[model samples]
Target: MSLNSVLPTRPIQRLSEALANQIAAGEVVERPVSVVKELLENALDSGATEILIAVEEGGEKSIQVTDNGKGIAADQMLLAVSRHATSKITCYQELSAVASLGFRGEALASISSVSRFELISRQDVSANAWRIKSDSGERWSALEPVAGKLGTRVKVDDLFFNTPARKKFLRAPRTEFNHIDELVRRAMLSRMEVAIQLVHNHKTVRQVEAAVTREAQIKRLGRLLGDDFVTQSMHVEFEAQDVKLEGWLALPTFNRSQNDMQYIFVNGRIVRDRLLFHALKQAYADVLYNGRHPAYVLFLSLPFEKVDVNVHPAKYEVRFADSRFVYDFIRRSVRDVVARPITQADAMRESPASVFERPDQHRQGKSVSTSFLAPHKPSPRESQAFFAFQQPVELPLSDVPSINEPLLQAYADGSDTRLASTSNAIPPLGFAKMQLHGVYILAENEQGLVLVDMHAAHERIVYERMKTQWQNQRLIAQPLLVPISLTLDLADMRAWETHQAWLEKLGFELEALGPQQLKVSAVPTLLAKADIAQLIKDVLADWRQHQDSERIESQINARLSTMACHGAVRAHRQLSLAEMNQLLRDMEQTPASSQCNHGRPTWVGLSMKQLDSLFMRGQ
Candidate 1:
């Protein structure tokens, strides 16, 4: 407890340049993926058009990145590997509007300190390439001329070899490689104009050609994201307040079990910002199933001054000067596009035109564009179907027992070829052919075939309708027989006070029992079955964690999802053809109907080519 001893234990001394770099390396060079990301950014910033990445044993043994970028001169080669050396920016003023991806200039220095590193570069105007080498936080060797292309090639060997502690944290080769692959994928997405190639253990893994056109971009996305994602995705382009967003978002039906596929880039820099992710989640809240994540590759561009990218050491996180505005912009953009009904163009993209339309249509003056589904207003009855189902009635047989004959007759009167030719007139879901095992609904549409989960689809439709109605009606408060009292921390109390009115709107009747306590008298009727105390605690936590947002909506939605599940039409219950058609029409009109409240795909489209491949067509 001696103050003098504790204060005098160490003298004020400057750290060695090597030690300083090693410390920086501890932050910047986290793993193979981190190194790859930094190098990729540097290559891109250097005006690289083509980048080739080679990894041996998941970048542990060696990592080589060759890029056709503007290479450095011999005099600059040493500086490039030195700490805090950068050509990206100068002076404090430049930090506010940094446009380069690797502006911190700590990556090369940091990485070289922990690994055996080499840099070879030959400027377009230079006679030959100059090479520099480094090992174990040592100063780089003198630049030596060597034969090389008019670009730069970086080689990292024995990563973390000098730091046994850092090497201990490295994951398995396959696992680390997965991280590297994902980083490369994001880098590729951030710069579509750049061709990127990845080689692991001498085996070519991923190769993307330069994309300059929309078609080429789509092809590249398809190659990376798979044809299903490309087919199921919607193109989005929106601008507001000089901020532009452009990308492809998978439809609500096209989702993943994990959030691995979500990529968001801010001004060409890939990031994992909470604000961006929260906005995306909110946008897909109504459409995506619970616990399911949407897949999207989005790019947002704005003036560099509007965002702060220098807040984090690794530059993976960013702080927007107008975070609220940014969030609203992204949310609105996604919602605006996702809320729109699927049209003929969407169907065409999902399958071949020949499968959905007559070959003569291409020859004729008429076009398929006119055949797409126009926006139709939903009927009040259809919108209120969820409420109707809640009332007493026969489950499936009692409602429309004899409605199928006429509907079946109408479909039976038209031949498959005729139906296919006049696709413009047919509904997007086409006509229901039959139900399979009381679960799946087999239907034919412009796109080869669509299989719908009758129960899941109806569940979503009902859930959406219920939500719409509930929002319009507002929550009705149900009084509790006995009041419940709870204590709150100062932060939670402040949150409760700030969000008092919002809580009241959600049908929570609570009053302050003391400075840090309250008595709950009532709760929302819809959430009456929920654990009231736990729900309140969760709401308070949300309010404290995410100020200026309605977290209760998600909680309420969860409860409503459970209700919809129970109220939905059960499987094995036979449906009349009319009822099935009505459901299909309802689905077309309902927003986010492609997915259930819990995020499961309600329907899947099978293209003709897929079917043909399965049957070995023309083989």
Candidate 2:
């Protein structure tokens, strides 16, 4: 076949400007939220400190955004709606370093192409605002003088009216509004100093005041996420290698079934990164149960030149200059908060009284005990508040704080009697009163009754202890008396070839007998009794596709968790009050002690107010 025969006779023609814009709209304007995202980004880029968003019929009918930002100049009115025109950046150097959330310049053009669009603005220097109108972005009206405030207002109506096919795909009003609501949430969180209000059909849907202080910020978070999330989350601020991460991480006990509550902002721009998300997953791997996702609102800030934000049309994905370093930084930073030993100060912060705190009194208001301000050494009183008065340790449990037996004696209702005396401060876990059915530990704290699952708590304690004991040592490889053989395909063979050293480091010894067959001579001592063949197959199967250390560690932990289960104290086994209290003390000090390895809650609290409510005491 001749090359000329394969070619088309006619040359391809350039697309019309209107068609080009509509095509761009296909990417930039997925739904009502897409338009809201673009407009809000523009408003923020304009240095707006206050913004108002109004929508009609889930934005299918109309969307109007007004911002108190430095308005556009009268001369730039036409170019503002034109394709590939933006004042945020002027050259390739600026493109490489996109400080503003919207730099692609396609958003306004793509948006105007598919809707009735109007732009009104009056700069600080202008005596009056100028207005420009566009219908499907093809023709624009000449700028006309109009009375307006010293800011900008962008109104979009009849979205996708020029393209019925796109309009036909629009979702239900409430559904589309929900998407818009979520998009606004990111915008609100992106700028806490900016006042934001959203109205739907003339009724205010949401509003947030400008948050200028730590207290106001926590209240804003509570209003957005919920009082429970606010109360149960902790503040995290970590910086290394010129990258700073500050945000809130919910306790493992306060996890979600889906990632609905996860929000990550990069330099005030909301983005989704698989590598960052995977790092988070690794951080919460051992803490969360299968199928459960952790909820967090993290903000990562680095130099403007270190990240590329122009990779996606919608600007949702970003590429970091050093993805690996970023990954490790996120993983280590979150893990330090997620998996550290709980201190007495931590328990005091989550005190029973904190349970009754108003929604506005969120958890993040409390500072972390660190050198972020100054190194704080807990006084003897701080650590000893858990006890009324120490009794010499006569019990068999090591490192267990023995308290006067009478100090543990509580009222029949499981409320502390000594705390009422005001002579001794109550501990976080309080004192163990008795064992219930050898399965639950009944305790009394200053808060109220606390019921703990003994087995689950003990299991977590032993697992964490084992992890610490083994943390510094290389995995000891156990040689098999008889080697197990397996047959593999080319992909699995390639995975073995690529990650053979990692496998060996994790305590696996494999030899390739042939291209299609492999023999395993040894495995980790921890997994000596595990189904070696199946484990290897499962790990290698995943290794062929996923090339992260998480997969290997997950497999190891699964085996280790099973081992810890066997080592933990058994359910339905009788124990003395001292033994029960010892377990409680261990739990208070253990990392992720609130949940077992399987993610089941190890303990639960019942505030006196809650208990009273059950009996209608107030009424």
- Candidate RMSDs in Å, in order, are 7.2, 7.4
What tens digits encode model 1's per-residue C-alpha lDDT throughout 528-605? 777788778878886565444655677677777777887788889887665676677666766666667765557666
lDDT of candidates 1 onward, in order: 0.78, 0.78
Report the lDDT tens digits of candidate 2 across residue range 443-462. 87766777788888877766
lDDT of 2 at 142: 88
TM-scores vs. true structure, each candidate: 0.84, 0.84
Report backbone clashes per prediction.
Answer: 4, 0
Model 1 clash tally? Answer: 4
